[model samples]
Target chain A: MQPGISKKRRAYILLMRILMWLSVALTAGLVLFLVTYVMAKGLPEISWNLLTTKPSYLSGNIGILPDILNTVYIIIAALIFVIPLGAGAAVYLNEYARNKKLVAVIEYAAETLSGIPSIIYGLVGMLFFCSFLDMQTSLLAGALTLVIMNLPTVLRTTQESLKTVPQSYREGAFGLGAGKWRVIRTVVLPGCVDGIITGCILSVGRILGESAALLFTAGFAHAVHGFFEGLNSAGATLTVALYVYAKEQGEFGVAFAIAAILMVLTLLIQLAAMLVGRYFKKRRDL
Target chain B: MCLPMKKRQSKIDPVTGGSDIRPPVLWDSLMKKQAFENFIYGVFLLLGLITVGCVLLITVYLIISGIPAIREIGLFKFLFGKTWASTAKTPQFGILPFILTSIYGTAGAIALGVPIGFLTAVYLAKAAPPKVKAVVSAAVSVLAGIPSVVYGLVGMLVLVPGIRSIFHVPDGASLLAAIVVLAVMILPSIVNVSITALEAVPQEYEDASLALGATPTETYFRVSVPAARSGIAAAVVLGVGRAIGEAMAVMMVSGNVANMPSLFQSVRFLTTAVASEMSYSSGLQRQALFSIALVLYLFILLINAALNFFLKRSKEA
Candidate 1:
């Protein structure tokens, strides 16, 4: 085999090998640089006071408590509404819908929804939810926009896990005189818990990272309030806050702190997704 | 209902409790259950349509708001005209600069990003050890998960300044800076999708090539890569969509100026053009912002259609 190789061919192979290794190194290097650079610059800026207080013009100091709370409120609000709609759509696709054409149309729509960028979502959200619907630039409008954006993720995941539920189990339930709703409620829905949870994690990660979509729908206000009050008022999530701070206010310290927090959250979400995947795999194997 | 059920029960007598109460009771409950099931089914069916309804709403909203500006500005002048001074005394609404900048910037990102990402995918899919692959893939996922704002922050504070000094430019924020940020941002999609496509190539293809006295590297590239070209193309299309649609990251570094795009000149993209002006714009300017969004949306729709085409072809192949 070695003797059969010509010098030109060997040189080409060597070049490719070198190129392959170099590209991989560059990819890895970029990731490393980003993670370490953000963390190194940001972690020191985070403080107990910074996380727990609000910005006061009198004090001429800034804090992100309101932004943090708004993030939590929007995430919760979006999930509360989205899970039911998303899971219901999945159930319809998996258990109820008999029309293949209808299912295909819905799936295609979901794909389109996912492909449309967040900026477009912001524009439409501002138009329909904020202006047309008279919701104004409030967190509620932002949450509704996110529900539409994440609906596909939730539906796809639930549909995947629903397929894994054995058909024999469904038949057995039917044989025992269980109605269609009963069969889904007792057998199919439980089987999809893992997917729904995974979807929630992914949505949370997206919600945390999102800024452009919320910029118009959720105006950048730093008001701390209860969940219902928060939803009615305009506010900024961490990502939006980071953008405003960095771009407009020139507050690099606060921006970096938020970046670090987001990075850590991203890491945690990745870990949780992997762990959930492994756990489900082991249970299925068993 | 109770009276009828009692009469039916009495008709069968108390001889067999199970058999006596079965017919009317069963019929009644079955009808009720069927109605309930139908109700729930309709509810869920409605739920499924909600996603479709949302897509329609977005499309309709964009068109309705987007048309006025174009109608006023003239489509040719709006899209092809070379000036975009929304606040000038006479105000020109031409968006050629934003359009060209978006196109050139996306092209630049693809040019710089795809080769490295493709090579990396090949290495991860075929050449790297299992342990190394695992670590690198995790890193890639982290890159994907980082918020766009963070990328902008890093680019603003680091890459822009670096470019300004290295290239001897007056301003750090330029189209070149935006391109570099976009190239980094799109790396994850290209690498991940290409790796998947490469890994999906059947083992037997490589096995046969190896048995034919071809080197492993040769077999991997010539056989495996050709087999996965459709998937790689789909990945590239996906990256193009991402690069073109990005707003926040590009907005932060591209300087928000509506200049004709040059490598080191400050420029605005289609996405940034909409985002930066929406807050304060009024009258025709406001409608024109909507029109800009419409343009960006149309670009995204084209990218999405191309992505779907590539993906469908890949699946078929």
Candidate 2:
């Protein structure tokens, strides 16, 4: 639109701008359609009875309480293992590691772990945890598999927060005659609590949505049990249950109901993550 | 303090320990603390090594379990075979169909996804107003956070039927459907990564271009894009990995048939081949599925290496 611009240059800029706008419109439109369509189709199928009771074969009644419980159990188990392991790894990398080569190797391993897909993790988990370890496709095996899958996420988040904790704090601790472990235990670990919390939320979201990884390591079953018993038993999470209902059982109604729940949960998680991140950022700035 | 106390304990305690027992007690407590510190360090070191140990465990298990089927089937036929019939009376375990389908599907997704993703990223990064950028970025993150099954569900109900009615195909589930689902599914990753890369291009570069009398569009394409080409390349590689490794969504819409890939024909991917049969397969059939998984893993490893190379180059740049 500038007065001195050539006609060809003007046309080129116009074309580029139009193309860019079109692409944005397409992406935004796709998201809008998906969110609305899913909510419309899935909301009607969710009922209180459908949520609280277990599936009954004789009465042809289906409920998702078991899947919900399994999801919670698996998330609890995976987090219990992943947090310490991931935080410890991050601490070693940032705090104690003096060997650059070892740091590079560990960081590279984390990257590779993130790059590998869930299905491969499922396969390997099935082979190692379920079969070789003789865990027999229980929820415990699935949780262990998820612990491996989520370690990188937790490690990266914790590492980022660890970096933000000023070196002066550590130096001050040392100045006060504190040893390395004590300094890390008291000062460094507490500073990264936000990151650990953020990582936990992210991991829970992923665990909630994961199907391919859990399909094998955690077999699809509808039986409900207590937390400890659930870990020792084979049961499906909400995502896997949705898959089984839609694909295997021709129960699109149940599938949509579960999908709606999952969609709501995903939104809530995204919001929580944003809030947590902003809260920590504000606190840190203060 | 501990060092001085240890010296005192060594020299004075041996001579008059009964009278001056405080130094020995202090030395013993200090040694215990040091040992505890060492033990805690060892524990942390072990935790750190667990990641490496996991990587090794996965690699070793895949190799050990994946080799047996390959040895039995012979590598050439297994890799280049034309048919895959895992349950037939005389089974044909050739996975050429799967490999080719996977390649074509990923290529198709990249073909469709990268351009739109690149353009959107460019707009968001360089052209959009702040409010627009914020809204679109939120949408992209929402897309990313939506589970694969939800995408598959939407695709199965909406896309498959739409494809069937529009194209006049007997069935809606086909390679084309899978490609479309994958394209949409990978959009968030491509757009997010490319936006990061494009945003990282120095403001000075664009300012220099504008000062040189070039328009913003030309500057972005000719100068800024070229500057961030490595990052864009990494985004594309990442999209490829996501497309190739996706199982559940593709399985839902691809019809789960092991046929040679045509745009409109039902076909299976390497991932779907492993997943669809995993629950029911047994004996040699099961082992063959593991072999398929191994093949898929190798493909992923290669893609991962390429992604790393591009990412490293971008970081260096």
> Over the stretch B1-317, how does candidate 2's per-residue lDDT look in tens digits?
22223456555543345474456676777667766776777887788888899898888888888889999999998999998988999998999999999999999999999999999999999989999999999999889999999999998999999999999999999999999999999999999999999989999999999999998889988888999999999999999999999999999999999999998999999999999999899988999998988899889889989999999999999
TM-score for every candidate vs. truth? 0.96, 0.96
lDDT by residue for model 1 over A1-286, one digit each (tens)? 3896999999989999999999999999999999999999999999999999999999987999999999999999999999999999999888877679999889889988888989999999999999889999999999999999999999998889999999999999988978788888999999889999989999999999999999999999998999999999999999999999999999999999999999999999999998998899899889
Native contacts present in candidate 2, fraction: 0.69
Model 1, which residues run further than 4 Å from truth? B1-23
Give candidates' CA RMSD values in order: 4.8, 3.6
lDDT string, candidate 1, B16-108, tens digits:
454645577766776577567767778988998999999899999999999999999999999998999999999999999999999999999
Q: If candidate 1 were superposed on the true structure by all CA atoms, what would the RMSD be?
A: 4.8
What shift in Å separates residue A9 of candidate 2 from its native position after superposition?
Answer: 1.2
Classified by CAPRI criteria, candidate 1 counts as medium
Worst 10 residues of 1 chain A by lDDT: A90-99
